[model samples]
Target chain A: MERTTFNALDPNSNVGCGRGSGVEQGAEETIFTEQASDDHVIIKDSCDVTVTTTDIQAAVNLQVAIQLAIALVLSVSIADGSQAQKIQQDLLQRISTKQLIRQKTYIENSRGIEVTMTDAEASVSIQLLLQVLLALVAKLDVL
Target chain B: MNESDQLANKLGELLLGDVLERNGFTPSSKRPLTPEQKQQIRTVLENLQVETERFLQHSQRTIRRESKPNH
Candidate 1:
């Protein structure tokens, strides 16, 4: 049987070939040996490689962040759809409820003259109508 | 938010104070809208009314389309 055995004599060398346990921290050493007989070896190989867990984790985190950003943008566009129309309708309804359709009472005075009296609930209703209209215009202008 | 939206927010706040004061309520500030501001607001509202009508019509059409059954 023909046998070949090689041993790496350098342990602290960074030249990609080494033996012993000083090949750098977190490095994995793989050894392969082929034996033709009980005392004869045909081929042998050894390698030391460092595995960077931080780099792999960072790459995974970046991929997750990208997916989250894409999902956020899609959700925002869908949620904002028809938002302007709803805002306009809400402003209009505010005016109608606050000012136009408020209840009032007509009371006869001591001289038999009828007096139109607005309820306390409707006191400030029509006064804020202009402000609501202004806001509605501003919203529609943006749209 | 964009510049226009920021401006609209500030203008709305100012209008709120003005309306409160004019309606016999005490406001946070005493700054009422000037006559020019009032006129500008009125003009904008007039223009927006036409657009609002068109928008409502378009929205109604969209609603009808979405409610229809697919063949």
Candidate 2:
């Protein structure tokens, strides 16, 4: 059995991103992770597991990034633009795609149950926010 | 119908209904939209497409950042 440790995390390492263009840091970006995990991944499976330290970080980073991006869009002056209605519909379409495919998540091996649970909760919150935004947009879409 | 199309249609209908009611029209009235009204709808569609593309890019970037390993 491989031993796992958490002393390799580099908050500045950039994870899987290679000098990525530019990371616009928003408050929400750091809301999930104040510090990156220095954890060394060691999976017990005979086969190599896909979830690594970077994967876990990326997952956390992605969720926050998406949250911030949506928030930014919603906070802009065009918050209630007529197009919002269509955009909301498009978002619904995108969210629905989750039901069409089954993804074998590595969360079980890469992260703890708490992180997985948090992700689920975040997903539900995001969906609810989208739905509420769309409802508001529908009411205002008319000229 | 595909889920995406169904969702798009449903949202479109809600928005369209509001627009029509405000303009003194109804879905069952079978009245054609004026040119200006049509233009407004087109503008909204275009804007949505642009924003959708941008959001997709953000998502792609996130995936790229997460998928590659530093080692």
Candidate 3:
């Protein structure tokens, strides 16, 4: 709160004693509307800053979520279907069958010259090593 | 693990961690594969098996037959 003094009219008015005729005029006016507008700008800028930060965080979160979704889809998409399951099951059965054959042949070899060359056979493994690379580029689009 | 490995592990957890936990995977359990994960893993293994077999068959056919080696 602002303080006011009636001492200008009283004998105790030491500071205002030497003042001119304009000194006794009423109190100065303040434009509350202008001050309110300034306060509004400050509030608006603060809100904008907060909103910008929130938007950036939201965008980052969305990007991470989208990337995760795509990866999840890619990882599981090819393996989701029954057709894929069937292919794998058939292949596993074949591997089991080969393993049995290999085991039986190994046992038989103990008695005589091996009838089957199970040990000589190359293993069925991921062939990452390249003996030769044959590249063919085919236009995949119908156009 | 490197950054990519860490990222992959994080993504794996995001996708399957809860599901695996629900399927009775404990930290101490060996190969605690959930039904869905097991199927996916098997599908991949089977694909690899089939591919290896096909390649082996092709190689076998292309290879020259050697005379019976002496024991």
Top-lDDT structure, candidate number: 2
Residue-level lDDT of model 1, residues A76-112, one tens digit each, is 3222434323333433343343222222221110111
lDDT of each residue in A1-143, candidate 2, tens digit only: 98533211223322321233233232112113322233332222112122312233434443444434333332331334444444434544444323211123332112111122123332333333333344433443422
Q: Per-residue lDDT tens digits of candidate 3, residues A10-32?
A: 23333222223233344232111
- What lDDT would candidate 2 get against the real structure? 0.34
TM-score of chain B of 1: 0.38
Looking at candidate 2 chain A, the ten consecutive residues that score lowest on lDDT are A108-117
* lDDT against true structure, model 3: 0.27
- For candidate 1, lDDT tens digit of each residue in B1-71? 55644554565556543533443332221223446654654564454444433332332110000111112
Report, in order, each candidate's fnat.
0.03, 0.00, 0.02
| Model 1 misplaced regions, further than 4 Å | A1-81, A93-95, A98-116, A119-123, A138-143, B1-71
Worst 10 contiguous positions by lDDT, candidate 3 chain A: A131-140
Q: Which of the CAPRI classes, incorrect, acceptable, medium or high, describes model 2?
A: incorrect
Each prediction's DockQ? 0.03, 0.11, 0.02
Cα displacement (angstroms), candidate 2, residue B4, comes to 2.7
Between the candidate structures 2 and 3, which one is better when assessed by lDDT?
2
TM-score of each predicted structure versus truth: 0.23, 0.25, 0.18
* Over 4 Å off, model 2: A1-6, A9-143, B11-41, B57-60, B63-71
